[model samples]
Target chain A: MNAVVLSPVDLAIAAALIVLLAALSLRLRLGVERQLLVSAARTTVQLLLIALVLKVLFEHAHLHWVALMAAVMILAAGREVSARQKHRLAGWWGYGIGTASMFLSSFTVTVLALLAVIGNDPWYAPQYAIPLLGMVLGNTMNGIALGLDRLTLDAVQRRAVIEARLALGERWQQAIAESRHEAMRVGLIPIINAMAAAGIVSLPGMMTGQILAGAPPLEAAKYQILVMFLIAGGTGLGTLVAVSLAARRLFDERHRLRPERVGSRP
Target chain B: MPVLELDALATRHVGPLDLRIDAGECVCLQGPSGSGKSLLLRALADLDPHAGEVRLDGVACSAMPAPQWRRRVVLVAAESQWWHARVGAHFPPGFDPAQLSAVDLPPAALDWEVVRCSTGERQRLALLRALALQPAALLLDEPTGNLDAGSCAAVEALIAAYRHAHAAAVLWVSHDARQAARVAQRCLTLHDGRFMAGVPAAEAPA
Candidate 1:
């Protein structure tokens, strides 16, 4: 089969349409719709642009581009997610957690899926590396954002118990432990909910994509398992980065919960 | 014995509120509704920002980290509202929330789903969680405010047990003078964002 490609015109039109749709939804005060739409559109535009660049990049097989792309994606994802969660963006952990998560998940999936399974050449395969990493990093971004939001909100709601913990001589980290768990639950809930609703309520994008790409049902089923594992890996890594890594930010220099940063939407 | 001093604490429509409760003592705060009886305690805990200091064990709470300060100073509400998802899920490993049963909380409460808890159950559960932590000072914002007379007395006894076991000072805020007298060794009446400790010993919790 001829390699599938999105023409630049088609890509641009899709991007413009998505932006318009997001704007309209935002105007309607449908925040969740706006969040999903904007994220999807941004991901689409970003992936398509990177695809074009990677096509040229693969021809050269330069290691610098691969490393640079990974770094850029990590920073970009971290920054956007931290920005999205705004006030709750706790310290430098966002960077560490985001980077660690993307590396652990994307590389793990890449290694497992390719070396152990497909047996593809490991030397600079843009096709597998870029797309798969994007999926991992993108979902991780959302996880971090959601975790931060929930954690901070929990801090507010669970103030009494948290303070009680502190009064018992528990350190700031320990005091917020239960609250952090709440945030983790909040962060992890979507994946669990999605898993629950998977297949019956909705066909997940990955499984559907594999099916549409002309893979046989069993082959697609295998891919689905792999994707699910990767997603699980990514979610775990993301939650760690978001919850623990965000720890430094939750407590101030004196280990007290700082008043949240002003001017946050989340 | 340590004391909790809310020093010149003021917030929007709240306080310039000031008072102190020594270690192993109970100080009651009385005020009409919207008079910031609860708000004062919330501000002292630094859950909300206010202009003032909360001193504990002779250390200026403002200077100490809020989390550190909070760990030493706990607040229990009348209807303890901070209960989490599952009663058991909310507690960490090994703080046997089972002991809450002595306080009229169910033994199974530690495992009961949080969403199913009634208002009174939530209050008791929050208290249990706080007591489990064994704070140095307990700030009770009318912890029995929602219960009936008999239930209120039962909660008071539970608190008495908690305080005796821990030797923790208690600052109990209430609208009832009789309840205040029963629960607190000393009472501080709040009016117009300030406190009148009434008598010298009222500054001390027994």
Candidate 2:
């Protein structure tokens, strides 16, 4: 066998695409460039680290370690949200949206992909389980971040309007309805745009990689559809949880919206 | 029954403080910036974390859900945020953009982006929103700071109307002696993060 193999051209094209994205972010002066840069760097380091550690886990098949890794991912993402919110509020929201939503949504996608899609083994196979779970959970984590950020910030800024709604007999949920819309709009827009522009605008990275590695067009398309659907599922569920939980922090026992922080007096 | 009560309130900036107001009364908190006048208002609203008890009509405010408490007891800051595209978009329900007419705004104001509103406009709109809610108590943090005479008159008239119609208890925070005299029924001065009785206001000068 001559070891008929895929060429490096596909890999080179992918690398170039990433480089262009980095340049575009800088050119646009998108303030979130830090988020993008850090996100990209983390992905690289995480993949490399996972590859080394996963080899051992794959060989030995340690269920405990797999569970532990999942927990670490959830906790780390939760803490990141905590750091941003920063307070007792930072605490409630971090765990509320970050931990509960992240873990619940991630676990849901993981189990579904495991049982129906990949056909889970007795001890979860690291190759299939970790990466697939990661894809769904990672998307959920990001949605939580986006949703919580918008919700918290809106609460701080639009307090007067919120109180007005309350005086008009609106409850926490009703008053927060507008803020929730803001959060959802910000959180879901990026993914919605990607979904809309996919295929026609450009072949997604996952599908393109599969095609480059000699998978047939139909096979790559199936993976693309699968990943996109899972992303939607993860984001939808995760956002709902994070927003609902974050809103809880705004209310007192009599069901009034509590202020996380007020302006400092002079 | 009192509309507002602060019993033995202990906060980050000050010690156990006590304040109370009856229905339809307006209490003014005035001091230099950073004297904790605003902090006291925030504490009463449970906006600032604190060790204190705040009661409204015999119910503990700190124990109530925050959004709900805010609904009934609102804070109108000097600069309140308007997040919508324009002046009219802030209303959650279909507020008949015509309501802006009552506030010196045209129906077309709805189409204008929020970036267009002047500081006075934001302050005015925030007050209008609070009045719209018909809150049981108002925690106003300088509602008139940015307004011109006309805008200020408009707000003053509305305050008088809300006081009459709703009997809402108002806690006004201001740095201006003139504005305090214009709006409040009674005034308390804040110094070193605590409330003291200010000089009696000139007879609500015409």
Candidate number with greatest TM-score: 2
Candidate 1 lDDT over residue span A1-266, tens digit each: 33266588977787787777777877998776667776886887887787788888788666678778877877787677666764554455545555565566556665566566666575446666666677766766677678877776676666666655544446777778876877777777777777678778988787788777766767777766666666667876667665775655666655556545322453
Which stretches of model 1 miss by more than 4 angstroms? A1-51, A79-122, A125-128, A138-232, A251-266, B2-25, B32-36, B39-73, B82-136, B150-168, B178-187, B191-206
DockQ leader:
2
Supply the DockQ value of model 1.
0.23
Cα lDDT for residue B176, model 2? 74
Worst 10 residues of 1 chain A by lDDT: A257-266
For model 2, what is the alpha-carbon lDDT of residue B38? 71
Local accuracy of candidate 2 as per-residue lDDT tens digits, A45-143: 887797888888788777888888777777877776555552325334456557788778778877787778868676377777777777777677777
Q: Please give the lDDT score at residue A150 for candidate 1.
A: 74
Model 2 misses residue A147 by how many Å? 4.3
Per-residue lDDT of candidate 1, residues B1-206 (tens digit): 67777777897687776676777777777778777878787776666667877788888877776665776777665655443567776565797755876667767778788778877777777777777666788878878756777767778898888777777888888777777767777767677766764743434433
* lDDT for residue B101 in candidate 2, whole number 0-100: 62
